[model samples]
Target: MNKKYLQNFYNQYKVFDFLHTIRQCGIISFWIFLSVLFTTSSSLLVQEYPGKVRQYTHTIEFDYVNWTFDAFWQKFLQSSIRLEDYLPEKQPSGIVREYLRSVRQISQLESQINVIYADPKITDKVAAAKSYQLQLDQFNAYKKQLAPYAESTLQSQISTILSENGLTLIGQPIPPVLYHSTPLPMALIVSPRNKIQQDANISLLADMTAGDMAALEDEVMKNLNVSALVVPIGGVGIYPTMVMSTSDLSFLAETVAHEWTHNFLTLRPLGINYETNSDLRTINETTASIVGTEIGKQVLKRYYPDLLPPESEISTQDTTSDTSNPQATEPEPFNFRREMHTTRVQVDKLLAENKIDAAETYMEQRRQFFWDNGYMIRRLNQAYFAFYGAYADTPGGAAGTDPVGPMVRALRKQSSSLAAFLNQISMVTSFDQLTRMVDNPPAG
Candidate 1:
């Protein structure tokens, strides 16, 4: 590994370590996962970009070093249990169940910590990754050293609530998994290529496509401190992890609904082979975002009604609740969703007419021409739809569907129930099959 990349990973480590010190705070797949899929996808990811499937099951360590943010998890559990007044009723076995849950949670966490440090952790594909470091395992050991004792106390308090509420719970381990890191918000780009030093901005992680990034340099490896709390990593099973500010807990379910969709699909990124493939990246993501949005709304409406009502338009205030102390300003209504639904129908028809170029041009100027002339631009053609599809909602990527999204959507559509959906897709064999199975799911 380039020392510089090692250094960069260490820098990320230090930042996560600091974030952990804040006692701070913190904080998924019950399917409703499938609904995120069962969406509008009807294309394959592999043919679009070859050699997509890479590995299986990422181990994400979700650490909450600071206890102050414990409120988020506490609230999340309460929403599900609906235990408004836990103290009013308590069962004698409650204490034992709560303790057992805690033990199971922490014990599993500890075992993972041990595995991370083991030499075998990266012996497979990760071993050859340009950014791989023999000493990176120690970062987990460092994280273990920094967990907030106060947070443990907070967990204890949370345990009491579970005891009284007729529940024995360990909140989904912050999904996929969370990690305690020093206060740095940096991320290390590890894969067959080295790009950590090349793309150091935190914004890039949230913005750029992993497949299109520049190559990593040897000098860049020396850029960081190994002792930092390197956290919630992005790997096979552990990714799309985000940092939330002191926003309201109210919208977390929605956020979880969104991210968990990524975890389930396990999209194959393009550009990992250094420009060998790029289209796959887009297909995976666009599919995921579109699916996630649809599924999240449906899940919220189906299971957690109080958090997300059926008939109401989701307010920005609710979505950003984690950060707002009292007031998260209201977001403007997106009447576009209503209008676009119908427009997409027509747009697809145009795309299928074989005048893709003409369709795209028509759609591009439709909105601009109409907005300037004072008319609604409803007939956006296929080309324009393709253009927006590449936009992929939350930034990053040059074009097409998001690999993660499409796979999840495809898997769900194939299975009758969520659990069955997960079981079949969890361990796929080939990238070709993975893509074909979902986008062109067997006709039912």
Candidate 2:
């Protein structure tokens, strides 16, 4: 892509972010032509679709009040340890390992509890509830043991991985910590009724109803210590958030590393302007995707070898493998990556030619084909692609054709080691830098 085209793409995102910010912050009403300010009058949205269009106008009934210091104190006071008690650690201790195991148990029990509660046939609800509560109580006792060490343990691992990979930790008195956030469902806004545009997204707390809110609430709220534009974040670099309760340790490790990369890159230009530039956003995501996966694999190899993907599965590079143990029952072979890649290329071409109806039809057919192959994808529309297409480093889904992904992957191949690869890529501040570096190699 030419510099002008890249600039145009970035400008589109910048416009959306600016307008969307006004909408989300409940300030658009104060401006003239509220509808025009909030939404584009593009004729594409009004065009006919094969299915009924569900129009969603963003609104903000009430401004979200962030939890104050008193709220933090209240939660902290509930814990046995003080916030300052967790000293920076070089490695995770036995307590960290035990805490993680307990967390896994709790997650499993909680999932079972949900299933039992949902089952209509279970007549002895009270008895089952009591039994589950007892088990939960046993696990919950570890919260005291967990509080002080959880963040430090995760931070240590992230720091060690980055250090090993030849990247310096940015300006911070201590390694970044991880706090488990409440899982929130992020709202994705797409244009053309069903087509996913690169811009237009707002993430409120997952519990907030998009139906009730006008066009304003659906806008991505930008404020202190929050970037609602980034979705499905298991971990965050700023203010250090992590999904500590995930039963899947490998995924948890990946998220820990992923968020750390964001923190590490924040001082660099690429991450600093991540939201404003679409290609930079993709580069950031794809970079983190690659680094995070490698870090996850490294963590498993060193600490939890049993959690590593089996040789058979690793050879195939099918991420959906059972990494927990070497099981007797062989996993049924399914290559969703290759199929999804093909789907993306085909869908992109259709959308490029302005064949919206044909594109939607093709997506549905492809979705069914995937389902028959043991992948259940519910509602594979433009929004699905829009959200998933960003991670181009991974071959699956809508990221197949993204030139940045291939360039980064090529850089990895040319580098002599993991550290060298990361060091070279970390210096990249722009899309052009990536292209130039990939095209020309430095003397060894």
Candidate 3:
């Protein structure tokens, strides 16, 4: 929060933001006009080092507020629902439905095009550009054919599940899916450098280049002294609640339900006081993870039964056994959950012991250990754990010794059904509420 450092950080972040805005919105002329306006209005007189005041004619606040994604959503909402072209007999047959088939084709094509566009090997720039446009056009045409049907079917399933579970907050219909993928891998900035502190939240995310993320993270960390993590987010649910068009059908359905859960919690105390209380933030994320997974499975079962694992096998694969030993599994193939859990707990222990440098070294050592075991993690720092350690809905590995995830899971176990679990968790606003609600809990 240092003013001088923030000023330096803002300059770097703003340029990336503007570039991302152009990429996502495709409003080149509009951005060009705005850029020219900002340039003309602002002038750089002198560059000063730390403790010196460097002034600008016009100061622009660098925040995620710039990324409305409004134009994209508005276009999607208007066009995605008017699917009067395809007849019922023309659609595909069986559990692998038409919408799923069409969406998979679109998603794969979109991903391929994105990869092509990012590739630097093409010597014929003009030819490559033309090909990109053609592919994009084809992708859009395909999307237009089935996006509405897909979105409507998915939303209907989500709504039915929510209603059945007594989650009536989503009774009113909302335009919840985007017809096309925006871009890949958005960067988010969380502040204060302390993993446990959650107040005064701020994040900047854009579907920009992966290379840009390293530079951006360094700027945020060295200059602004904040925690930054760039995630390949499947879906984002800020307001309108959107699923990335290119996501696999199963993942797409799950993400849609996941994001909607975020939207649903936004009206409650857990969401309202999200930043003010770190534990509440954990509770909120854990709740979403739990509900989203359950709802996603239900959607798969209803629409794409083939995607759903057999109920008999679910206990073996997905569900953690109530009385299962932690040491029961073979030590091969790198258990990420157990390893990540160890990292979180140890990192906290070191940080608590006033060993800052030791904590960092510990993380790097752990990162190398993971790499040695065939898990290539790019970075392992406080910032990384600070962002990812929130979701504690499911137990083991990531949950580590974090009381929130376990407490939430325990509450779910005590409940009669998924709906009852969600209903009880929704009523919880703080860690204290979780403690009071659960029985035979871990002693503080």
Candidate 4:
């Protein structure tokens, strides 16, 4: 009897361990999925999907950013980390400085292309997208050229970023499926791993509504980041409508940079806990946006100034930059970065009042206010921001800037060495630790 009892206990222990592991691997609902669900735009189901691209006569031009993709990326990431070098008169270690500088170049290029394509320029390519077939052959050719580079350079860095997390295969080495028409918002994997199908479009996911958000929260993203809803919708949406995955060199130049920032802080335990909180979420995105944009800008300046030109004039398409605004309808005019900053301010005031339900109500009210302001904002909720935090910001109690997103503003005030800051940050295990390192470091 004693032997039998011992065996049964062992079996139960095994089952408990097995259950715990599985439970740890899955997702929870993001509160944002509860925000809004509209009647499926019959438009989504229309027999012929109205293609989003436009038509033009001039053959669409594929302007090279000039620098060999590798050189461009290296300089970009270097600039991102140099701030730390400037900070405290110290700098990022060579390895991390190289990694982040390259990442900055990659992310900003992605943002730039997204903005460029969205603008009224490139009529030929736009037309091709709208059923006109233009010569994307050059674009395809460049993509092929950068294929190995992205797989090796950008993807590898991404792995380093996600080393601690089990989700290491976010980017694969497989060849991309090339489409004749420009797939809007390139690079999206609906089902994890190789689903035997491919879509490069990964820009604006705005059409999603409350119910769809719920389904996705219940069925998809929540399993990864329960606060996925609060996560800001990434990718460019405007005259230069674009997404994370644009081109190959650009892929290395951008997508890897921005997305990897998400992978970095996401490995932390506490950041995961607040993944469902809006204030926490904004802090994450704002941080990443600021960092990523700065890196991108500097990289462009150094390596591909021609492709992005030093020109300052806005394209006709960029009427405004004002979304992510707890107050606006679009992501620009004020742009996502500034909007995030302001939202940080607003969410703080609302939270201090401590009328919790009222605060929640404000989410929907603000979203509705978006519609009232003439822009289409699907839903608003704590979940929306929660999932958004993965990008760059973190939960700072009262909700300041996150430590991750690729925002430029943060770098503006960074201490001596980008390399030193990165070295200290690389080993951190939680968002709080990362922020503390950034905000107040113990003497070396």
Q: Summarize candidate 1's per-residue lDDT along 219-263 as a digit string, tens digits.
A: 222233111111122211123223232122223333443344454
lDDT of 3: 0.57
- Ten-residue region with minimum lDDT total, candidate 1: 194-203
| Stretches > 4 Å off in candidate 4 | 1-211, 214-243, 247-252, 260-291, 309-357, 372-375, 389-414, 430-444
What lDDT tens digits, residue by residue, belong to model 4 across residues 155-228?
A: 34333333322223444311111011122321122211111111111222434445644554344344432122
Full candidate order by TM-score, most accurate first? 3, 2, 4, 1
lDDT agreement of model 4 with the native: 0.35
Model 3 error, position 40 (Å): 30
Q: How many backbone clashes can be found in candidate 4?
A: 106
Q: In candidate 2, where is summed lDDT lowest over 10 consecutive residues?
A: 220-229
| Candidate 3 backbone clash number | 2
The C-alpha RMSD of each candidate to the native structure, in angstroms, is 19.9, 14.8, 13.4, 20.3
The reply for model 1, stretches above 4 Å from the true place, is 1-175, 179-240, 243-252, 263-279, 286-304, 311-364, 369-411, 426-444
Could you give candidate 3's per-residue lDDT for residues 1-444 as a string of tens digits? Answer: 114433454454444466665654544444334333322222110121112111110122222223334534454343322332232432322222555565566666667666767788966655766765676677567656555455545555677666666666466422233223344225343435444443222223444456766765565566666555455556555534545555366676677777777666655566555554667878888888888888888777765677776778655544444435687665444556667877888877877887777877888899999999888877777656656777676555544587877888788877777766765677777788887888643344
True lDDT of residue 147, candidate 3 = 52
Residues 1-444, candidate 2: write the lDDT tens digits: 124533444455443466656653443232113223212211122232212122332232111113222223333332322222333232344545676778778888888898888889998876878888788888887654564455545555566666665555363312233344335334443434234445544333444443433333234222111111223435434323334356567888887777666655655667666665567777888888888888878877866777787888666764434446766577666677767878888888888888877987998999899889888775566656666777776555577577777788788888887667766776777889899998889987
lDDT of each: 0.35, 0.57, 0.57, 0.35
Better of 3 and 4 by lDDT: 3
At residue 31, what lDDT does model 4 achieve? 11
